[model samples]
Target: MKKPIKNLGKKLKPCPFCGRKMVFHKEIRINKYGKQVTYQYYLHEDYDIYHDESCILDEIDMPFTIGAGDANPDTGYIGEYAEDWNRREG
Candidate 1:
């Protein structure tokens, strides 16, 4: 038998500190009733809280980071971060 579809509505919130808008970036798929379904999701607001930053694309260092959902391998480190490592001023 087939199952009823579920509505997946807005799942993002704004940052409390910086008031920046957030969006759904990640989700988990699971098996339910012999069918594939979406499970727990990490909201963007929660990400901002944990990251301790307001802007999602702000400066950050992940090479020496020690967290599960903290490192962003796509964009690498921030420009200012690289300058700081080189001990050079902008």
Candidate 2:
């Protein structure tokens, strides 16, 4: 299904690579059936630089919340995970 764009805001913690601060990059809004799901993603890089820089070091799928009433009774974000996968590998 088609989706809309939304702003999520700033990051909650600092970067693990350079210790720089991460900021909210994009809010991916997807509509399934009659339900609308919103996801907030962050940009671990500068605000000016375009394109995703996180792909350089590693890919991350951080934790987030679904907007109120965005999910229907049967479907929506069923789970969440931290972006700290880098720490798991030896």
Candidate 3:
């Protein structure tokens, strides 16, 4: 099993568009079958305050997974998700 992504000890990159700090969030919810599903994503808190629903680009959810309902402990996996979004040009 892979190691779980740890929020501690790692530095989150800033949003490229607004120069504001980025945040990482992981939500664990149980599916209908009672399996724990982890939804990992990032958000630009400052950007959401001024933008409308269609204009908001703050939340970026990870689109892929290692396995079916698998909980990965690899910090790098989740970190990359945030990093990629922060590096987006628009």
Candidate 4:
């Protein structure tokens, strides 16, 4: 199986919009059938971003927030998610 996330681990930059620090997160999810599990890793600000409608989610509790989600661990597969976030023009 492919890696779930990839970050060059190059130093992370502060958020340009808020000038605040960023945080990383990991999440595991199972499809509706509850037979498979998937992983996600990403970065986000230190505050609540969005709320999910429980009725629609079925059972998963993935939150929607700022930052990027890397489903693949390859350096570019999504690990670049951080690289892209770090590239903020601020």
Q: Identify the candidate with maximal lDDT.
A: 4
Residue lDDT tens for model 2, 26-85: 244657676665554444444333335443344333322222223221333212322342
Better of 2 and 4 by TM-score: 4
User: Which of candidates 3 and 4 reaches a greater TM-score?
Assistant: 4
| Worst-scoring 10-residue span by lDDT in model 2 | 2-11
* Model 1 steric clash total: 0
Q: TM-score, each model?
A: 0.25, 0.34, 0.45, 0.46
Model 2 Cα shift for residue 21 (angstroms) = 1.6
Candidates in descending TM-score order: 4, 3, 2, 1
Q: Give the TM-score of candidate 1.
A: 0.25
Candidates 1 and 2 compared by TM-score, better number = 2
Candidate 3: tens digits of C-alpha lDDT, residues 24-81: 4557788999999776544443334335541223334332121212223353444454
lDDT of 4 by residue, 1-90 (tens): 233222422245654544544444455567898866645544334334353422222232343233444434454343555667667676
lDDT scores in order: 0.31, 0.35, 0.43, 0.44
lDDT (Cα, tens digit) per residue for candidate 1, span 28-83: 35565676653222233333334655353343432121111332324432223222
42 in model 2: Cα distance from truth in Å? 2.6
The residue pairs that clash in candidate 1, if any, are none
Per-residue error at 11 for model 4, in Å?
A: 3.5
